[model samples]
Target: MRPSSTLLLVLGLSSTLTACGGEARSQASASPVVETTVAEPQYESIEQFESAAIKRDVPYVPTPQETVDEMLRLAQVSRDDLVYDLGSGDGRIVITAAKKHGARGVGIDIDPTRIEEANENARTAGVTDKVKFVQGDLFNADLGQATAVTLYLLRSVNLRLRPKLLAELRPGTPVVSHDFDMGEWAPDDHKRVGDDDIYLWIVPAKVDGNWQWKDAAGRSIVATIEQEFQTFTGTARADGDRYNLRNGRINGAEVSFELVRAGDETAPVLERYAGKLANGAIQGRITAGNRQAAWLAKHD
Candidate 1:
């Protein structure tokens, strides 16, 4: 006989429930406190990529493959070229240079992820042996090793990189840019690939040192030369007088300057210097007025 109670329970229960209740105790002990591990979210390297975008980013838009081929063509890239691509998005430029032209190259981009993607792209292109990619700022990237430099940066970035390009790249090294120009330093050549514009520049020789050379009459022309990239300005001292140099410019190995001899200046004499710069000397032909004579200038 059962009495009414506050607790609610069936008096009789299952016969298969382990007669000693051993199964319930075993189950309770088996279920120890479970712990889980959460993998930390992968973050970009602070040394390689900034948490916030810098002014340098020109967005991630890739240059068309056809346009890239055109750039290489216009630059006249050969087997001797060591092409360097600034802001290399997916390494297409350097890969193309290596695969298509058999040139060695390096692609640089500040974003680490972009560099990873670029390296993968290079591998897929089968140019991994010829080209490599790095993560770094494009503005400060080393340009000395490059025989040809490629750019797809904005106009402002182009202007910012112009000095480095002129200073580091060797004379006659071709620099090709897609879309943008280097301010006043005009392009040596231009071409259109489909609807895109490509510009090229041949780095001019450094004529920024003091030179001593003789005129046609052996005038002992000791000239002071100062250069800013391709443009130059300085006085040519001869005949106990200083002559001002006008229209002074350098294009690759080509140099030209108009010299006006002091007060008797009626019209400026055009002096065209065509020579090979080597052995710390500018040795070539100097054409002035109606006379064209052999000229040799030694760095003083």
Candidate 2:
């Protein structure tokens, strides 16, 4: 298969910020209207469905009610939040977000049939005014208005949309995914809702720079990170040798990614670091050779 297009693999959180000359709307404003798109049922199985959902291009299964409630519990949605449900299916998430959390919501789906079902569901739930379902591609939807986001997409799709979501939404926006994992990035919290797992991630503020860490051996390793908004490039330097590090964008208040180093002739063959970043500190599993250690990163 062809490598996923950045656009095809990712959900396009509305990057049409005022800076991009998108229709000027109040900051943190939640539109009372529900926005959605024409529908075309593309998949039947959960796996096939989510795979399409992640690309922000295909239609998939609607979120179950139990899952919606679980997302609310995890996100702690409130009246002030603007929630967006990508691949809204039957609008369960958006409607519930409005009904229970008192938050306004927008649901986007490619299937017009699903949009109709969502609208009816919103009305039946007495949340029509607060929730609206539009017929459109999630890839083309404007997610910047959302303070909270709920998804039931695929892992690859989540990874693809990862950068766009971070770039558009401000730090602290809550993102909840039902069954999908945001590759490379870590979630702040997660819980099991019945047999399913829900992951919650918060967008972190932009504060990327070079950081140096010292081991107990008195040897210092410096990591130079260049952040482009949320996406980043990092290199680790120890002694005279340099190594490339794997890194992912921040989702909300948390930063979770991976780092790896290959050994030279004189050195061992493998070194790996994986963990979460919070409050200027990094903590997680660090592996070098057969030994594993804890790691931390604090502000300079």
Candidate 3:
């Protein structure tokens, strides 16, 4: 079969997707898919036909209504949120976001037919003003303005889109995907809804800098952080000795780290740093050697 005009446009634009300068690329999912390009019609009553305008390479698979609700619920959509539904088959996720949560939504699908179906659904749901659908490549969709994103694409597609997602979306944006995961990005929360897996990840704030402050005990503490997306690997200096930090976690403004080393009091004195990074400083509490103290750090 000759390639569709839309598909050609999408492939032509894939090279610049990471920049997110414009609308979609060529391919979008048009129907529910199993392991391949075959359609497994799950909703014959609502959508009688799966349009043959398969926009993207992935087989079409429309998420069940129950799963759609769970995905949006996990993302905590609100009136203030701008939700983006990638590879949006039939536009169920975006429509639900606008109808149930009162949030504005954009659904991107490669198949023009699917986009039409989505717009029809949105009109029926009385969310036509708040929800819009686009026909383009999900990878090429500009997601910088979105506060929440929903996906039902394949595992490879999720992994491929991971970097752009991390880089384009701002901190604290929650991404909820149904069935597939972002490989190494590690979800902050996940749950199974009726045999379907839903994953949620919140973008972490940038906190990679040198910080220093005095403890409640008048002890000087200095620390350095090396950040990777939402997590960090770093070291802290205390009392003329440097200690390695383990289990460092950075969730948005929240931060925590631990240190364990041999000491006269215990086999290994465990020091825990639980704090928040904000306004160019870190402030929280620390526990070391059976003593608790207020922790504070400043970063320029």
The lDDT of each candidate is 0.78, 0.71, 0.78
Error of 3 at 124 (Å): 0.9
* Residue 299 Cα positional deviation in candidate 2, in Å, after optimal superposition: 13
Q: Please, what is the TM-score per model?
A: 0.74, 0.55, 0.72
Q: What is the lDDT for 265 in model 2?
A: 30
Clashes of each: 0, 25, 13
Q: Model 3: per-residue lDDT, tens digit, 1-300? A: 112223234445665674463332222334335234546756443323444535466656688899899999999999999999998879999999998999999999887778888988988999999988988888888999999999887677888998898779877899998877777788899988776788899988778888787754676867778887677877677798776666788887788877654232243636778888777777899887789988887884
Q: Which ten residues in a row have the lowest lDDT in candidate 2?
A: 1-10
lDDT of 1 by residue, 1-300 (tens): 112211111212323454447766666668787444557656557633452354445656678999899999988898888999999988999999998899999998877777888889988988888998988888778788899999887676789888899889988889998877788888888887766678899999988878888876678888887886678877888879777676677777777676667555575665666667876787778787778889898888
Q: In model 1, how many backbone clashes occur? A: 0
C-alpha lDDT of candidate 3 relative to the true structure:
0.78
> Which scores greater on TM-score, model 2 or model 3?
3
Q: How much does candidate 1 score in TM-score?
A: 0.74
RMSD (CA, Å), each prediction = 20.9, 15.2, 11.7
Index of the highest-TM-score prediction: 1
